[model samples]
Structure formats: structure tokens, C-alpha cells
Target: MERSETTATTRLSTWRQVKRMKLLYLLLLLPVVQLFIFQYIPMYGVLIAFKDFKVARGIWDSPWNNFEHFRTLFSDFIFLRALRNTLIISGLKLVFGFLAPIVFALLLNEIRHVRFKKITQSISYLPHFMSWVIAASMLVEIVSPQRGIVNYVITLFGGDPVHFLASKTYFVPMLIISDIWKEMGWAAIIYIASMASISPELYEASDVDGANRLQKMVHITIPAIMPVVVILFLLRLGNILEGGFDQILNLYNPLVYEVGDIIDTYVYRVGLVEYKFDYSAAVGLFKNVVGVVLLVTANLFVRKVSDHGAW
Candidate 1:
């Protein structure tokens, strides 16, 4: 009888807690439902990757293609080049893009004037809201050899104007710079929020210790936000195989394909353009598998080293 009463009390307590948080839970339900409908449900379509998918037969009725598509992808001459381009571009973005945001956050944190800082941050973040198509078109105009602003400046300086977008040698760097410009400000917002959460008492204490501005930044500000940095970096590692598909597709041309084409663009060209869905699916599945493995590895490393992980 006593045990039964205890169980009943526990259930009542749980019910009360849920009742207290009911509105918040209700608000979360819409996104949860949408995720189920859009994100989770679409995962079922991934089965087509393992099959010789046909429109008439549909995903369910398609025959299993085994590993034939993967074999074909591996044997393709362009496969290595696509893989190399994807890795190189993603790697550079990870290194430069990752650092750019952190540096921007740090610099913004040091700004003393409120109005100026707000204006600077607002202007910097504006580009992030622009569609990739619009941004890419703007970039093309700026980099055009004939009349683009970048080439115009080069010519003004007595140097020959370079074809930035068309040149294989310049494409990767151009992509990296454009990506940094678009995303650094947006990414820095996270770091800035993390910085805000840092206790002002720590800065006061550092000031009392006669620590200079740089010293305080290095000791207090950075350490306070290090966890946020670690988590974001780990997340980036998970998607190391993906080089911004929309941005790349909009920016790159066939002339720069050797240096600029990534896995996503290659998949699009092969699947939709060439009607090689099986081959593209195989490539996509490979990327997804690698991403999952990398995410798990990064999570484990974070847990072991810092006692914090994605989970």
C-alpha cells in the first residue's frame, strides 16, 4: 500500500512539472512536427540510393543495385578530381572561415563605442541575409576581367587585370574569400552571445590585478567562450565533406570545374543533368557515411579532452 502511494505521488509530481511547462512544450510541438514531416520523413527516400531507382516503379519497387553504383563512381576518371576539389575547398573554408568569425568576434568585443560597434556589426551581417544567387551575381560582376571592380583596381595599379572567376588558380581562393565575407559576421554572433554570458566580475578581477586589455582578453574572454568555440568547430568537422552547394553552384563555371566543383555540384550534374541517379546516390551516401563517422569521432574527441560533446 505504501509503495503504491509513493508511485502515485511520483506520477503526480511529473504531471505537475509538465503542466507548468505546457506552453513552452506546446510552442516546441510545431517545429517537432515540421521536422518529422520534412527532415525525418525524407530519410525514407534515402533507400533509393541502394536501388536502381525508377520513376514508374518508385523507391519502394526499385530493384537493389547492390554496390554497382559505388564501383562505377570509383572507376570514373573525374571522381578523384571531384573528391580532391571538394576536400581542398572544404579544408580551406574550415581553416579560414572558422578563424575569421572568431577574430571578428574578438575585435567586436574590444570596441568601446556602442554606436560605432552596432553599425559595424549590422553592416557586416547584412551580406549573410542575401540569397546566394544575388550574392554570386554581385561577385561575378566584381571579379569580371573586363569591367569588374576588382580588375578595375588592378588595372589602375598598373597590373594586368586577371580573370578571377575563370582562372583555375584563383577559383579556390576566391571561393574561400567570398564564403568568409558572407558567413563570418553571422558566425561571430554566436561567439558574441557566448561572450555576453561571461561574468563581468572576472573582468573586474583582472582589472584589479593590473592585467592589460590584451591580457584580459586572452585570459578571461577567450576561456569563457572556449566551450562554444569547441562545439561549433566539432559541428563544422561533421560537415567537412560539404562545400556549400548553393553558393558553389551559383559561383562556379565549367571553366573552373577542375578547381571549384564539389561533391554536391558533381552530384547535381551527374544525377539531374546526366540522368545518373544511382551514381550520384552512391556518392551522396558515401559523403553521409563519412560525415556521420567524423561527427562521432569529433564528439568522442571532445568528450575525452574537454568533457563536453554534441550529445
Candidate 2:
């Protein structure tokens, strides 16, 4: 048949093109090998979740406990507390932290003055490059009750000096606000780049129709970069179980643990601090499985709502 001949000819042409680009394929080999060695090879460690893993016996010789760890995890109060905290913290982060970057990008794009815009942007994202350790120290100083600037201001206003970090009422808000402040401008870079790619002709057409800056932003700019926004949201959703481990670990104290403790910190305390490796590994596996399920469901939901989806 003519169709069979055309298919054969197409395959031959594709083969020739690939032969021309063989060096690029050679360049790609390094990362493929690294992915296997770093990401894929370590996955066998998940077997620890199913085993009563002893250090002396090693993974291979460790006897299978068959689902006992999982059974205990569901019944355990500590594990349940970590799970609940992870959900609450991560959900609040998605609610408040998600839109900060998008809003930053939109506001930045409206700045017609080039020099001020550049300086402001440089300062805004600077905190993102700082390690959480240094940031946490600075945050503690700012919120410290005895001699801190925040308390000094409160005293000036005749209000009582309140310890922001130590309070259950204020701890989560501090976390959210600090997180948004640190990461907003850095994350906004994506939306800014997407906005830059929009054709000027559309804006020109909008100008012809007497559209204002805000109107153009809502109708022209936002719609154009929505696919990028949705993709980033989906990726962030997939990592929802993580709950900003490094930030919380650096900033939180025993006093705040009742409100601030999450899955990663819980895992650290269980596995490293208490040396319950098998139990910690099971918790980690549960986190990853939930992440995967959320990712798939988000993908499905996005597909129904819009044509631009991860699929």
C-alpha cells in the first residue's frame, strides 16, 4: 500500500536527521546516567518501609514485617499530629504564598521607570538567595520581645511587647508572611518571562480600543501566562506534603512545636534523632504516595477546566 511506503520513507528520513544530531544525543547521556544513579537507584531503599531493617543485617537480610509499620502509623497519635500539621501548613501556604509571586510580577510589569524597577527587583529577590539559617536569625531578632525593634515599636505605641514567634496565634502567620516575602520575587521571575514573550501587537490592538493598563493586564496579560501559572501550581501541589521543611526546622522552637511541627520535622525526629529508621521511611513513603495522587488528580481537574494542562 502507498501508506506503508510513505511510513517507511518517513522513518528513514527521521533516522538520517538523528544521525546528524548524534553529538547532542551524546551530550544528553551524562544526565541520563546521573538520573539513574542518583534518583532511580536509591528507590530500592523503599524496601526499608516493609522491613524491620537492622543496620547489621542490611536491606537484603532484613526480615519483612509485612505492613506493620503502616498499621502503627495510622493508629499513632504523633504520626497523626504530623499529618494534620503538614496539611494545615501546606494548605495555608498554597492559599497565601501561591499568588504573591503572580501579583509581584504584574505590579513590576507596570513600572515604566526602568532604573527604579531594576533596583527594586534586585532587592526583592535578594532574600531568596539567603539561607534559611541566616534569615531565621534575622527574623528572631526582629520579633524578639525583650529588646527587638518590633517590641520597641509596640512600647512606643503603649501596647504590650508580644513575642510573635512564641505565640500559637501568630506563629503560622509569621511562617506564611516570611515565606511569601522570601520567595515571592524569585518565583515571579517565571511569570515576568512569560509576560515578556507576549506579542506587542496585542497590546497595540488593546491601545487602539482605548484599553487602560489594568484592563490590558487582566484581559491580555493574565490570560496569556495562565498555562505557565497552572503548570507551576501543579508542580507545587505535587510537593505539598513537604511543608517547607528547612524553613520551619531553622525557625521553629519547642514552644512552637505544638503548632509548627510537620511531616519532615517529624520524620527527622523519628529517624535521625530517635533512630527509628524503619518507621520514618514508612512515613516518607506515605508522603510521596500522597504527592503522586494529588499530582494526578490536579492534572485531571486542570484538563477539565482548561485545554492547557500537564497532559
Candidate 3:
């Protein structure tokens, strides 16, 4: 009887706690519903990756092909080329783009003047808000072989005008540079916020110990935000296969397809343009599987090396 009364009291306490937080629970309803409708609901279409989907027959009625699409996807040379480019481009961006924000944030944190810092941050972030189409248009105007300011400047220096947008030699570098230019400032916002949260007392103590700004940044600021860095790195690893489709689609042309093509663009060409939906679905599935594997591997490696991980 004592034990039964104790269980009843515990249940009553739990109920009262939940009752007190009812409004907070209600606040989560919209996001949960949106996730279900937009994310989880679309997962059902993944079945088309394994099936010979026809519009007339619809997704449910489509006949299964038993990995035929996957076999075709693997055998296609174009798909392999796209896959290679995706890895190369995404890898380069991961290395350079990942570091850009960290460096920018650290430098911004070192800035003592408040007004100058805000103005600089605002200017940096403005480009991130611009659409890829607009950014690509601006890039094209700047790099135009015939009348662009860049080529004109080169000519004034006694250099030959080179076609940068159409040249495979410069395509990848341009992609990386443009991407960093657009996103670095926005990305640094998180790191700057993280740096701001570090204790002022630690910096004071470091100053007391004769530590300079650089030394304090290395010891206090970076260490305090190392976990955030690790988490962001892991999240980026999950997108190792995504090579910025919108930017590439807008900026790339047939002349640069060999070096600029990526999995997402290939999917758009085959699935949407050519109406080979199943093949595109197969390619997408492969990309997603690789992404998941990379994310898991990176998470595991990070966990082994440090205390931080996605989980």
C-alpha cells in the first residue's frame, strides 16, 4: 500500500510539472506539423528511386525495377564525372570556406571600435542576402571577356584578356572565391556570437598574466568556442556531396561543364530536363547515402578525438 501511494504521488508530480509547461509544449506544434508535412511526408517518394515511375501510373502504382536504375547510374560515364567534380569542389569549399568564417570572426572579435565593427559586419553580410542569380550576373559583368572591368584592367597592365568564366582552369577557383565572398560574413556571425559569450573574467585574467590580444584570442576565445566549431564542421560534413547547385547552375555554361558539373546539376539535367526521373532519383539516393556515411564517419572521428559530436 505504501509503494502504491508513492507511485501515485510521483505520477501526480509529473502531471503537475507537464501542466505548468503546457504553453511551451503548445509552441512546438507548428514546427512539428511543418516537419511532418514538408520533410517526412516527402520521404515516401524515395520509393521511386527503386521503381520505374510513370506519371500515368503514379508513385504507388509504379513497378519495381530491382536496382536497374542504380546499375545504369553506376555505368554512366557522365554520372561518374559529375560525382568526381562534386567531391573535388565540395572538398575544396569545405576546407577553405570552413576556415574563412573562423578567421573572419576572430579578426572581428579583435576589433575594439564598436561603430566600425558594426558597419563592417553589415557590409559583409549584405552579399549573403543577395540571390545567387544576382551574384552570378554581377560576376559575369565583372569577368566579361569583351568589356569587363577585370579584363580592361589586365589589358592596361599589358596582359592578354582571358575568358575566366569559360575557362576550366579558372572555373573552380572562381566558384570557391565567389562562394566565400558571399557567405563568409554571414557564417562568421555565429562564431562572433559564440566568441561574445566567452567570459570577460578570463580575458581579464589573461591580461593580468601579460597575455596580448593574440594570446588571449588563442587561449580564451577559440577554446571557449571549440565545441561550436566542431559541431559546425560535423554539420558541414553531412553536406559533403552538395556542391552548391544554384550557384553552379546560374554561373556555369556548356564550355565549363567538364569541371563545373556536380551531382545536383546532373540530377536536374537527367531527371527534370530529360524526364528520366527514376535514374535521377537513383543518383540522388546514392548521393544521400554517401552523405549519411560521411556524416557518420566524421561524427565518429570527432567523438574519438574530442568531447564534441553531432549527437
Per-residue accuracy of model 1 over 112-179 as CA lDDT, tens digit each:
99999999999899999999999999999998989899899999999998988889999899899999
TM-score, prediction 2: 0.96
Question: Which stretches in model 3 have alpha-carbon errors above 4 Å?
Answer: 1-14
lDDT of each: 0.90, 0.93, 0.94
- Against the hidden reference, what TM-scores do the models get? 0.95, 0.96, 0.95
Off by over 4 Å in 2: 1-8
Location of the lowest summed lDDT over 10 successive residues in candidate 3? 276-285
User: Which ranges in model 1 have alpha carbons more than 4 Å from their true place?
Assistant: 1-8
| Residue-level lDDT tens digits of model 3 in 84-131 | 999999999999999999999999998999999999999998999999
Q: After superposition, how far is residue 39 of candidate 1 from its true place, in Å?
A: 1.2
Looking at model 2, which ten-residue stretch has the lowest summed lDDT?
Answer: 302-311
User: Over the full model, what C-alpha lDDT does candidate 2 score relative to the true structure?
Assistant: 0.93
Among all windows of 10 consecutive residues in model 1, the one with the lowest summed lDDT is 71-80
109 Cα displacement, candidate 1 (Å): 0.5
lDDT of 2 by residue, 157-244 (tens): 9999998998888999999999999999899998999999999999999999999999999999999999999999998899999899
